[model samples]
Each structure stands twice: as C-alpha cells, then as structure tokens.
Target: MSGRKAQAARNDELILQAARAVFTADPGAPIAAVAERAGVGISALYRRYPSKEALLQKLCGDGLKLYIEVTERALAEEGDPWEAFAGYLRGIVDADTNSLTIKLAGTFQPTEELGHYAMRASALATEIHRRTVEAGVLRPDLTTADIALLLEQIASIRVGDERRISELRHRHLALMMDALRLPPARRELPGPAVTDEELSSRWWTGS
Candidate 1:
C-alpha cells in the first residue's frame, strides 16, 4: 500500500481503539472526545466517520465481527470439548466484547448488517454449548443464553489498571468455570434458564 494509505489505516485503527475505550466508558461521550483520545484532528475523524452514530456503528460492527471470528476459531480448535468451551470464554473475555454490550446497549440503532453478525455469533455459541454439554463437562441445564450473561457478569468487573483488570477477569472466570462444570454432588439450579428470546429482546429494534 502507498504510504499515505497505510498511515490512514493506522490512524483509523487508533481512532477505533480510542472509540472503544471512550464509548465503552461512556456511550454518551461526544465524537470529538474520540478524536481527542486518539490524538487525531476533529476534521480527520469527521472525514472518516461523519458522525457519532456512524462511529458507534463502526465500533459495534467491528466488535461483532471479531466475536464471530473468535467463536469460529474456537470451534475449529482440536482437543477436549471442555477446553474449547473454556478457551472460547477466555477469548471473548480477553476481547472484552461484553463491555460494548454493557456500555453501548440502547445507544444506537440496530442495522441489518449488525443483526446478521449477532445471529451468526449466537448460533456458533449455541453449537459450542451443545458440544460441551454433550461431552458431559458442562451442566446440562445451562443454556447458551446463560453464557452471554455469564460473560457480561465477568466483564462488569473493573480494577486499577488494564493488567489488573485482565488478571481479575481471568481469575473470576476460572472460578465461574468451576461452578459451571458438572459435579456429582451438586443440586439443580433453582431458576429457569435464560431464554434466547430474552437475549434477542435486548436489541431494541428486534434486530
């Protein structure tokens, strides 16, 4: 690629990274805040994203795409079904995709493109849950929808620094993983499992 084109690509990534940190912290943050966070001129950000909603759409689109890719990779991985399931959770937690869900929920309109990606990701996750349960490692009553909420619960935690946050997330995740695993002496969970319908309802427009 040409030098200018390459530089533009780098700048775009920087802006997107900044947008993730900014909007994921405060979805109400202005577009200019992203430019400032990215150390890019406001005019340049405008030239690329046009508006705050446009930037948000890009962030969600990119995040959804990354999530689908991670799920597909986890499914393709060789070894124990339990390992794949655990690895998948670890991957998404490290990706911190749920931060976008927590911070950007109801912040923007749902597009058909984003909806398609979400559906695909959900299907892939369901397949992983099925395989893990069939392997007798996961609790049978835990639904695929529960995985989403579980990850969200883990992602809700925040600590001193990025390194500390990651450590805490992984630590909590390991504990949660133990709880999720099937055990001989455990009693049945009392509540009804989360439904896919409820998961779908989170998207305001039914996308």
Candidate 2:
C-alpha cells in the first residue's frame, strides 16, 4: 500500500476502535462522538463508513465473528463439562473482550459472512450442550434455545452502577449456572423460565 493509503488504514482502525467502545456503552451514540473520541474530523469517518449503520455493521460483524471463534476454541479445550460450560459462559459475559457481542446481539441480523459464522457458532453450541448433557452438568430437559436465552438474560441484568458491572454479572451467572444443573443439585428457579415468545419480542431485536 502507498504511504497515504497505509495512513488512512491506520486512521480507520483508530476510528473503529473508538466507535466500538462508544457504541458498546451506548448503542445510540452519534458519529460525531466517535470522531471526537478518535481525534478525527467527522468527515473523515463518513468518507470511510458513509453512515452510522455502516460503522455499526463493521463493529457488530467483527464482534460476532470473534464470538464464534472464542466459543469454538473454548469447546476444544480439555476440561470437565462443568468447567468447559462455566468458562464459555464467563467468556461470552466478558464484556472487556467482546463488548459488542452481547450489546449487538439484539440488533444483529445475519448477513452473508456473518450468517455463515452464526451457523458454525450455533453448531458448536449444540455440541457443547450435548457434551454438557452427556456429562450431566446441565439438566437433560434444557434445550439449546434455553441456553441462548439464559446468556441473553445474563446480558440484560441492569447494574445500578457501572463500577459494579463485572461483580454483578459474575454473581448472576454463577447463580444461573447452578440452576441449570439437574436436581437435587439444581435449586428451584424463582418464577417461570423465559418463554420463546418473550425472547423473540425482546431480544430478537434491539431493545
């Protein structure tokens, strides 16, 4: 690449990094805010991404792809079913590493490349669920759909203060994991589990 082209690429990277951080915190953040964070002019951002949706598509795409890779790698690691399942839950909930994954999951519709990635990710998740069931970590009645809903529920836990986000998320996730195990190990989940209609209405699209 020419020097100018390389420089432009570097600037784009900086802008994207800023946008991801901003949008993960507030999905409705303006492009000007991202430009300010990137220390670049708004025009520079538009020249590359054209619109906010364009920039968001990039962040969402990269985040979702990384999510797939992480899940696949975690499944491959040697561990007991409980360890593997717990680690994968922690990984998906690690907003530091995949801020946009959970943030964008609601609004994320599968495009061509991302559609393929989603398929692979779902397959891996199914395999993980199978292993968990065979090992008797998760209850036999739990479905893959149930697992997906549980993760989404974990993401939707509203922290009263930003400082408490990690602490609260980890605590809630541990509680949920315990409830996923078979009885007499499993404690009774308060209220009913999330149903299909509710998940589709709330989480299948942006809140």
Candidate 3:
C-alpha cells in the first residue's frame, strides 16, 4: 500500500479504537469526543464516518463480530459442560463491560443489515445454549432470550464509583451461574421468561 493510504488506514483504526472507548462510557458521546481521543480533528473523523449514528453503527457491527468470535471460542473450549457454560457467561459479561457497543446492543433497532447480524449472533448464542442445556447444566426452562435479558441486567449494575465494572459484572455472573444450575426437576420460576416475540419487538429505530 502507498504510504499515504497506509497512514489513512492507521488513522481510521485509531478513530475506531477511540470510538469504542468513548462510546462505552457514553453511547451518546459526541463525535468530537471520538476525534479528541483519536488525536485527530473532527473534520478527519467526519471525512470517514460522516455522522455520529453512522460511526456508532460501524462500531456496533465490529462489536458484534468480536462477540461472535469470543462466544465461539468459549463454546469450543475444552472443559466440563457446566464449566463451559459458566465460562461463556463470564466471557460475555467481561466483553459486555468493555465493548460499549455490545453494552448498548439492546438499544439498537435491527435495521436490514444489522438485523441479519443480530440473527447470526443470536444463532451462535443459541448453539451455545443448546450445548449447555444438553449437558443438563442449565435450567431447562431457560430460553436463549433469557440470556440477553439476564446479561443486560448484569451489565446495568454499578457496584461502586471506584469499583471495576467488569469485576462487579463477573461477581453477578458467578451468582447467576449458581442460580442457573438445573434442579432435580424444573422448579417453578417466578414469572414467564422473555419471549422471542418480545425480543423482536425491541428493534431500535434511531428515535
């Protein structure tokens, strides 16, 4: 590649890295914040992303891609099924705490392109859920949809101002592992688990 082209590529990656950090802290952070973190002027970023939503959309896509890769690794890992399941939860919680894009995934309205991505990610998760359930480690009644809501709840916790969010999230994940273990039989849950219909209704429309 030409020197100028390579430099441009480097700048783009830097902007993306900055966007990930800035977005994680505040999804609504202005484009200028990303520019500041990237050490580039706002014009430089605008030349690449055009708009805040456009930039965030790209970041979200990248986040989902990373999530799939990590999740697949967790599933493929060599270990006891229960351990694997717990590890999957831990991995996702850890990723969620870092990737601001994944943290805000629930807010994304699945447009045509992103909807397919969501489905792909969901499918991989379902496979992981299948393996975990097949091991009889998870509560049989727990649906794949439940994982989204559960992790989201964990992601929202703020244990303390000074505490690490990943540490807090992982702590909750440990608690979740204990609760997720299958009983001798399906014990009655307090309420209905999240339904697929309900989940599909959550598409973000950029409102």
Best by lDDT: 1
Worst 10 residues of 3 by lDDT: 185-194
Cα lDDT tens digits for candidate 1, 90-127 = 99999999999999979999889999998999899889
Best by TM-score: 1
Q: How far is candidate 1 from the true structure (C-alpha RMSD, Å)?
A: 9.5
Residue 29 shift from truth in candidate 1, angstroms: 0.8
Candidates by TM-score, descending order: 1, 3, 2
Report the Cα RMSD per candidate.
9.5, 7.8, 9.5
- All candidates' lDDT scores? 0.86, 0.75, 0.74
Give me candidate 1's TM-score against the actual structure.
0.87
Model 3 misplacement above 4 A: 1-6, 97-111, 159-163, 183-207
Q: What order do candidates take by lDDT, descending?
A: 1, 2, 3
- Write model 3 residue lDDT over 34-88, tens digit each, in one string: 9999998888899999988788778777767777877888888878887777777
TM-score of each: 0.87, 0.73, 0.74
Residue runs of model 1 more than 4 Å from their true location after superposition:
184-207
